[model samples]
Target: MNTTISKIHPKEIKKVTLGAGAISINEIIAVSRYDAEVLFSQDYRERVNLSRSVIEKFLDEERVIYGVTTGFGSNVTETISTEDAEVLQKNIIRSHAVSVGEPLEKEVVRAIQFMILVNLGNGFSGVKLATLELLRSLLNHQIIPFAPGEGSVAYLAIEAHMALVLMGEGKAWYNGELIPGNEALEKAGLQPVSLGCKEGLSLINGSTSVTAFASLALYNSIQAAKTADIAGAMSLEALKGTIKAFDPRIHSVKRHEEQAITARNIVKMLERSEIVEKYKDYRVQDALSLRCIPQAHGAVKKVLKDAEFTICNEMNSTSDNPIIIPEDQGDALMVGNFDGTFVGIYADTMAIAMANLAKVSERRLDRLVNYHVSELPNFLVAKPGLNNGYMIPQYTAAGLLNEIRVLVHPATVDNTPTSANQEDVVSFAYFAAKKAYQISKKLEYILGLELMAAVQALDFHQPLKPSPVSQKVYELIRSVVPTVEEDRYFYPDIQFITNLIHEGEILNTVELIIGKLDW
Candidate 1:
């Protein structure tokens, strides 16, 4: 139930994530600073040094710098005296902390904290060691800033995140209370930094906020897909849908790789099942969501894998620009490393595939809950008409599906060239990642509804049990959400399941009872 990832080697991120829920900041600390030396190249060192020179120039002459010596975004070129850069940074943080939606959940906020720390620990941002320590301390203490929800443009997630780091103006949590960053810093015995040369630009230039969305999205999407596969098979049993459609021979000919993989997994999950049958009125086929689980879910799998590769690379790589070149290195030319395009496209890919997966889930949930076709009780209620049963939960699920449809629009498609068009053509990955997360969070509740619904129907199967593996799943849900003999207030139960599912306790239960499955 705790579902903690014990040891995380950076390369084994996927497996670790499947087990632990999210990558913790502790993971960055696992790789010592020595690894940082090997990860950066001579060119990396040269760029960092060159970047340092630019910042040094701004400092030595008190000349106005675009972001550091002035303000940020749409006002980057305004000249500010060097004395004001620190105040500028603080002001930027305070004024830009204008996010609109509900505050991000703590786990989500923690994910953001980890990402920022990882980026800084790579030592590419020219961030002082002390700043990194502040981030680490905040993470370890469970104090998180309340990052607002607006300001996610396609090309970048600026205008908001910058306001906090530079100006120390935004809200942060110290110990547990939300307060201004400076107050939090003071409470935590930390010192804010000077917005030296490229520091402000470095702090707010990238998309860690968006990347946080991507990680949480990708993480939840992974669990949702798994939940879909398991629940799809369970629904197959509850509906008495023919297993022949998932037969190996049917998928073998198409060379549909995922089809084969899915078939194998379903077979594994359904092994020794008391419910599924080889012959049922010799029924020929299953519904598309059920029958096509391999294709739909597998597409998500492949896309998630690609997105993971990009995201992991981005997390480990340096994205700050005007990079410092070490004094010892001379062969490299200064260039831009702040581009988030790879993830921008990948985030779009994640949104598309994640929404599609949710679409598939909606279809299956419909089949499972709508008693007219389910041949089970209406909404899986034992005494229909008197008890509404799962009817309202379906409403909740449908709400999420509709929301995902709205968010499925690609975030990367719209981009405004910035930096006076000097840095034209942006990835807008931040929006892509954030929306991916938003859409995916809504999806958890939807999947929870369907999962609970399917198990409820399975409960009505008289004396039959699902596979041993799935019996555990059914019992797990059944334990929390008792079979609805007559519908009562079931929303709380469904909500509880959704939260537990999001916390990944159910997933860990699966891993504990059965063996871990592949993507």
Candidate 2:
């Protein structure tokens, strides 16, 4: 009752978290459409025209502006006719759509659209209300634009989004078929939004994609880290780990906040476990993976907390250049792009933390599979030389682990100058963070495979009984993997078992019987 819970509000368009799953983008589209209702409200559009009057006064008086009348980027002082302004903006979006890469996951595409609508509705850019309405109709009617993922690199999902807006060349999955942007627009009974002078600049030149991707990655990372803790506890019991290693006195000296906290959690998870407490006579210390769970998992927790603060702020704030600035001297607003120092640093920091999580996870998988420590028949085999056992699973895990290392290289570290050196250093932070998330999923499946193998090995001891908690895990795996006797292509079984882990079947099943087990 005393605790505070975080919640999302569509009314506060600035800080909204994209909803979960494929239709999340659509959900945010609902909110963005609502905001559109506000922006183009009979009262509000009048306010925009009123806002336009200020710009008009400045224009008639010949003020030196940025994108209002002048050309963008280095071509600042080169002014264009107000009549040609809309054409200039349209050209910018079209020219910048030169993104190359795979199409974004549908949810990401939706987030980009929602963020675009939200930014436009903020009443900064001189976009007509129809611009936002066209996007709303596109979302409402499921007319997805076929945007490339090539440009969602640095700023929040801007590159591909700009591409989709400009040439109107993007694909969207409609009903069950993917279609072209023009067709999608037509099918939705809408025309492509005609951009105003600063409208396209306002749309493409921001960080919504990066923010959305970063936020999703961070959310999943928290769950993965927690899953790691549970996995560590499970592995510890299966291996007969020593409680002494997790003793509060040992952690008290280090006093690292999350480390100590997680060490305590591991202790609590192990309490009353008959295997760990009773099996102490069997082993003096568990392997490094089991003993050092706190350090590895705790590090991820700290990183996640920091990334949360940074990304949440980024999602709520603006990253567009030539940002509107209210000036008293002139009726027009002074606008310019600000530096993205914090987003760059924090996003990269998040990437590194996630990489380390996978690094440690790969090690744990090795402990379970490498024939030496696993104490099984060279690979959790039931027969001596007749079978290969879980050899391929280990190979798959190792291969995936190596891929994580390659992706772990920080995206922020290499800053190539772009926009004629106007954007000298860059973030591409979401690039690293997004890849880190994909790698995390692979590792989860990898670890789940290893857990299956470990459980298979444990079952060879027909007479020995595991602690109540681990017994549930073993039962969960048994329900899927069964006891692999002679050997039949085990990949399908591995997949079946890993899916249980990925989908929380094992964990959820464990929770149901856990209280009864007295573990």
Candidate 3:
């Protein structure tokens, strides 16, 4: 399946329905990046009302509920009367919405909003139906809250910032202008929602922020994995590597699904190549980086698949602190679902996986540029000493790889207690997801460098021509970056190829020709 979301024109996409267990990465990307409208289903409204009625009955009976008729965290023992419930909810929003740091990207905030909306739509959070509609209004109107990138241990801090926007208390971007949340809501013909029956606690008590980050990173990493295969194939042609290593017969015995798929993709991409066929018996075996693209890249693929499974599961689940069970007659059950340990650990795993991908890509770039390994012109330039072609890009890749190494340290393993030890043991899943996002970006750039070098080396093969698929990739690359007969400014070349990778042009073009590769 092609999990990659293509960049669609904003006007082409229609309003999508969001609900529990139905939110997809494509849907999130559609609403967030493509500005598609969203609608809350009538089913969600009915469910919300049923859940709300339970809470209302409890309130009428003077029953104490955690974070509702009582204070939050360590203050849970302090009970409040019905008259003070609204004030408690509002105060939680006011005190908890203290996130500081650089503002999160618009796309991240949009995803967070979508996840929160979906979590509440699960009909277990005890928020009023009107409050859910208000969030839907924000999504449909393209009013994005200015959520900060830090101050989240679970998701309370960031979710508070998002909820504040609904209350018209935070900042938001509307019509491409950053304005007060109140003004944005007014301009969008929407009004701030009032807290009623656990609305404020329901709004901010979830793991939506880390879930959104992991979801976005999973999509990007899948694309990066496929691009790595394409770039690896190009490098194979440049080095005249043996396809014997990627033979299905060789991979079948190992029985690793991702490895076999990657080996099969390498074979398919390099099919009918005169270059690969010409050097049938020149060497016994290639080096590990060249010979084991399937092993390294395939391991990353497995890791991504695991993280995808974990994240999608998280998306379907309600991560709220105290879940309202309408089936149990609206009883609020306090649970630890809000803890983001699963997302944090899996996201950390993905960070290591992406870092490994970057490491191999950087080393492959080394192999392409070094004459000792590639047997191409020194520095891949005809006049090696004078025009240092692609020499510095390898160093750049190395530096990026070094940074990835540092980022791969498990954020989950290091936890700080928050909320007065009432919430002891925090999950830094947000930081883990953030680092994975950063690693994926650098991974794309590193692959771009490899593609640039591989194409340069393949040019030396002359009119021999590459595999039909490789020829298309080479031509597409040349369309943006010409053959480097001599080095002019190379940064522009890197930038263009990086853009190609990021824009999914290269992946889209190759998949168009060769069909979809195994994810």
Candidate 4:
């Protein structure tokens, strides 16, 4: 495949400085998505050097440290001589780099690299300063490692694959070409360094992969959540669904912050709507999908909110085994900080949350196309029988929802022992975060179909226009996809609208009209 890496102007590129404070989710997104440059603060360099000195002191004292003088996992008892310590480190990376599948997207690989910096840069992983410098060089230069998308439990195989690139052993993408790792480094004016006492273990061990996926997924899921509100508002207006359910008084009585905020957002989006005003008191209540949107969408928002805290904490944490503590006199404490339970559970929860968002969106999509309910023409088309306008798009939405449902099964709930049962009770957080990321993409498409159908349903209302916010959203959709007078290839229309949702165009447009939606 032809892959081209675009170069950003130096002045335009944003730089994220580590070691100053905890890395935020926005900074991670900046590096991964926007190619933001990463810099190490002087304090970060000092801390990393201090941590590395601890390992050197341990080796000098001939103290038996885990993964330093002793073998890892099940082979913890196996001792290694000083001369063979470096070999063992390199060997572990080679042995563990066995993940097999399609290569992950560059953004994900970049996120993994950034998380590695965050984890080791905390001065607990005993990683050498040069080691982190190389990793940062790879990110700033856009030399992405070729990490496979599958075959990881917690974070071992994939991280091993990534670690191999630093050793100048595995393949990497550089300047749009998949080249040898060493060559990629060479082209980028850098050289690989030999693994130190615990460098390899520090590189591969930990919850880096799971946390990387969770961070990216959480960021996108937040955007998708905001877009879901816009889509739901448009659907409510199109269905002539009453806005009484969204009154501040009704939501205030419940005392759920997100629920009240969602109710307010829906009301704000539908302000000055001729369609809604004409249909006010048209019926006792609309369908639960339209009427109870605040409750349903707010619940999803709550999950996303909770996930942000968990994921951001994980982002700034050091999830290394046998973390080195200078305060404890360079003592290498063997611990289970690498366990991915917290991140795994949250990632799984985010997946379920996104699936529910799609579920509610599909219901509203049905209301838009099904003539039995939607007052508009069958399937939101001018001539429904002749051209199957939106009949099949709803099917597409259902298919995507089904795929998301299958992925919602928590991977963290299951485990298999490895390392000769020494590393038993594994947290399959890698898959959980991976599936959550996958579900977020599918949810975007589902929401896109809802917006597409909702826009069509609004067109039928004619002189009785939607609210100002909804009209702005409609214009944005119409700019990308024209009204479906007669169905031509519908996939492009769905794709265009999906792009709008994915790029936050719909949310951005709505927010411009009615401030920001509450988290």
lDDT per model vs. reference? 0.65, 0.60, 0.85, 0.89
Per-candidate TM-scores read 0.82, 0.81, 0.95, 0.96
Task: Please provide, for model 3 over 195-284, each residue's C-alpha lDDT reduced to its tens digit, 9 standing for 90 to 100.
Answer: 885888888877888888888787778788999999999998889898889988888898689999999999999989999999857789
State which candidate, 1 or 2, has the greater TM-score.
1
Highest TM-score: give the candidate number. 4
lDDT of 1 by residue, 16-56 (tens): 11112233422432222101111333443444445455456
Greater-lDDT candidate between 1 and 4 = 4
- The superposed Cα distance between candidate 3 and the true structure at residue 160, in angstroms, equals 1.4
lDDT of residue 467 for candidate 2: 55
Tens-place lDDT per residue, model 4, 38-107, is 9999999999999999898898888989999999899999998898989999999999999998999998
* Model 1, runs deviating above 4 Å: 1-102, 154-168, 278-281, 327-334, 417-424
**Residue 73 in candidate 4, Cα distance off native in Å:** 1.0
Q: TM-score of predicted model 3? A: 0.95
Model 3's lDDT to the true fold? 0.85
Ranking of all predicted structures according to TM-score, beginning with the best and ending with the worst: 4, 3, 1, 2
- Model 1 TM-score (2 dp): 0.82
Error of 4 at 180 (Å): 1.3
For model 4, the run of ten residues with the poorest summed lDDT:
1-10
Cα lDDT for residue 192, candidate 2 = 74
